[model samples]
Target: MGRLQRLSSNACQRLARRAAPQPIIRRRVTYQVAGRDFLVISGYEPDGQRIFYLKKLVRPSLQAGFEFVYPANRRERYDRDVEAISRSLSLVDP
Candidate 1:
């Protein structure tokens, strides 16, 4: 799967309350997970590869946020995201 599995109902409700759309930039979304804030981003290359970047954004909502960032040079970010999803969801190993 290219994206994380659909969240559970309770999680969905929380996320709906937390999500805030912002301009595309170093950060793509603001969402709450387990009552904590997270910054998530994804990118695609011309070759049709996809990757995600996740980082915790803990703060007073204004004093702190991630600085300019992009996918790490390492190619395994996609692999890790995929593997983690499968593992946590009890799906077969990819």
Candidate 2:
């Protein structure tokens, strides 16, 4: 929940587990695009399955795509891009 900090290759692999209770994030996928880094974390609970994704868009040219599912009973409710990145990175709206 804290800012994910700058993660190394090993750190990214380590996050691929259940670390919290709410939202119950259980899986993480990480890769690089252009020059920046991206990460996706998905999980499921009794209510439904949710996916929270994060991307560090270091390169402004790459297309950004991510999704944030919060206790989502339906997948279509959440946006599939910037909002997802913000949610995963804990970015707050001003």
C-alpha TM-score for every candidate = 0.23, 0.28
Q: Which parts of model 2 have CA positions greater than 4 angstroms off?
A: 1-48, 59-69, 80-94
Model 2 pairs whose backbones collide: none
Clash totals for all models, in order?
0, 0
Candidate 2 is scored at a TM of: 0.28
Error of 1 at 91 (Å): 29
Report the Cα lDDT for residue 30, model 1: 32
For model 1, how does the per-residue alpha-carbon lDDT over 46-71 read when each residue is reduced to its tens digit?
33333343433444533232322234
Q: Model 1, poorest ten-residue lDDT window?
A: 61-70
Model 1 clash pairs are: none
Cα lDDT of model 2 by residue, 1-94, tens digit: 7675788888776776545444653454432234334444455444345544444433334445444445445546654553544655532333
